[model samples]
Target: MENTSTRSTSRPSATRVFVARLVGTGVFDPLGDAVGKVHDVVVLLAHRGQPRAVGLVIEVAGRRRVFLPLSRVTAINPGQVITTGLVNIRRFEQRAVETLVFSELLDRVVTMRDGSGQVSVRDVAIEKDRNRDWKVTRLFVQRASSGPLGLRRGETFIVRPDDVTGLAGSLGPQSAAALLATMEDLKPADLAGVLADLPLARQVEVAAELEDARLADVVEELSDDEAVALISALDAARAADVLDAMQPDDAADLVAELPTAKADVLLDLMQPDEAEDVRRLLTYDGYTAGGLMTTEPIILPPEATVATFLAQARKAETAPALAAVAFVCRPPLETPAGRFLGMVHLQRALRERPQQPLGSILDKDLDVVLPDDSIGTVTRLLATYNLTALPVQDEAGRLLGAVSVDDVLDHLMPDDWREADDAVTDEMIERSANA
Candidate 1:
């Protein structure tokens, strides 16, 4: 059969509008093969704010509800609506539902709160406007307070639609549909944050709707434990792809947190170097500097001049942690020959004399640490010196890695660490079980 999925970019014509209006009142012919009665017209709004009839919700024999998009509509008359193709209700039901209208979401637990206060939403405010258009105008909340009658009137709060903490736009049926359709357009970080607040089932549902790259970003932003949990919920192939897209250190951490058999399966699917880095980090104690540091940073030779360092830095594809500070070290910071000479802040490197030897301009007296240092020691050093990051070195003073303020915060908070622990745990279990 010829495909009837219409892909139109233009607004619905006058005739289309008239037909849409008659949707609930008219009978529908399934291209002369079957018949049904229209129950509703699912309107999809264009970017320009024009409402277009995108689909028809019809009630079939025995009270079965079926939806038919405009593309499937072959004809429409005063008495009857004609569909050009057949639709399997079971298949339609199986397809993920997207863009739920505010009306439909009403009475459902939604995240909202009074202005500047804690988040709390007891009920959604449904207002009938002058035009009789029903809209979710505000969120109602209950608080504690005293009343004028010498009796306490339960404290109640209202949150205007404008004050919504989440994504904005209309919460009408059509708008809800549009939100669902364009959900993938949002950045993963944004989507992840929103999803993070949702229940696990809902998170999985929304995650399945996202593309691989976007899903990867969501996973990357999640706490290490959360990422591992989410990935474990996904199919092995999809989970592996997300891990592969993350930074090597992050990927390793997450992999370590997973169950051994699964982690091994995922590792076997990943590239060798990435799997190795994650495996290495898995060996470290969770509370140590080594556990918090990322291996991907910019390293500079002690002999390199400020000018050269600037040039190299400009060209180097370093992570954000490395980009903030230029570390100057002699030979191997991990070996006896290596020494932590000094460091150059990016701002200083840009403004200072270009011809000056890096050693002369470098902050010779630098705060450094051994890999085995406790989280408490690292946190204290960072707080005392007010440093953005501190270099971690071996006993010989070779730069093994550097930990950022974020890493320290993660160590302290524990909740902020993403994806690394699970990956390590998985690998360890796998190795031990195999042995």
Candidate 2:
């Protein structure tokens, strides 16, 4: 729900309070009997804008941390939190959709933009809305220096949500839709990071703002579970659009993870031609050549000249690996490919003869892979040919698609690759950034 309450431009210096400021404060029951110390702040991740504080984690007798839902709370102040007569003594287990301010965000590393410096989060300020729900508004960051045999703390400064680049920083209550407009320039990986760092509801809101192509790019970089979660958050039509925009093989891989009924619905919503490609890929074992190959390759007729191939290659400059080869076939490209002639490697074209006939320079002794070839077999064939791309064919000799090196590595790399976008070498990021 949108918070329509009047709010300050930022957390007022006079009344700004932090999660750290509340911990250790005595919690009093409605009858005024002291019960325990405020152990932590529990926030609901499903808020409309920024997540709101829903309750306090109190350390009662026996060192048990119990849930005290905000709905049961009576009063909250800096020194102590006074609860209503009702309190659930059951131990609290953090839910997938909840966040513990102290455990998750505080002391985390964040880059502050105004100074272009990275600092550690020292504390965070939370404020109340008209409905009395508490929402996080600002981050307090500080650097630490080593003192003589001791840890010396640096001065902490406030960085409102507005100040952090690509983050939903806010000075006050902001419309989720408004926050999305500011995210246009962010890369999918950057967008994913921002989404991951935001609350669940805000993640869905930001996702809703992205175009299908943009969201597909982001989804490709997310883990399966995370991708499924995000896709599920979207409306059915939008989710289907996003799946359609992704590489067919990748789309099928993800679709296979979804419950069958849901997967079928998405496939049904997709364009018939696109859905057919995914359906074909779904039939291949995930570790086979067909499983990893993308259905959208640059295909050219056998009579097409090298210049024609060059034009197609130029269109794929952003993804150089995709230009590995131009599949050549007879007219009316379709099942059985009308006679699989061969391919023209982008690098094999001599600069002196840009107009050379592509058919005349067909990749000689071509090593084609069958649909069910094992990844190891595909890898060996690719290595033996010194190829950056290899063609996958059906038994009938149709040029199905080409498998780029990146597609192969995507499956072999460590599971955490998508989570470490910033881990790229500066040169790689710089080239991609400028390109």
- Give the winner by lDDT: 2
**Model 1 spans with C-alpha error above 4 angstroms:** 1-189, 197-217, 303-321, 330-340, 353-357, 414-435
For candidate 2, the 10 contiguous residues with the lowest summed lDDT are 1-10
Clashes of each: 29, 4
| Residue 340 in model 1: lDDT | 72
TM-score of each candidate? Answer: 0.51, 0.58
lDDT of 2 by residue, 255-283 (tens): 98888999999999988888899998898
lDDT per residue as tens, model 1, 138-174:
4454333343333234444555544544423323222
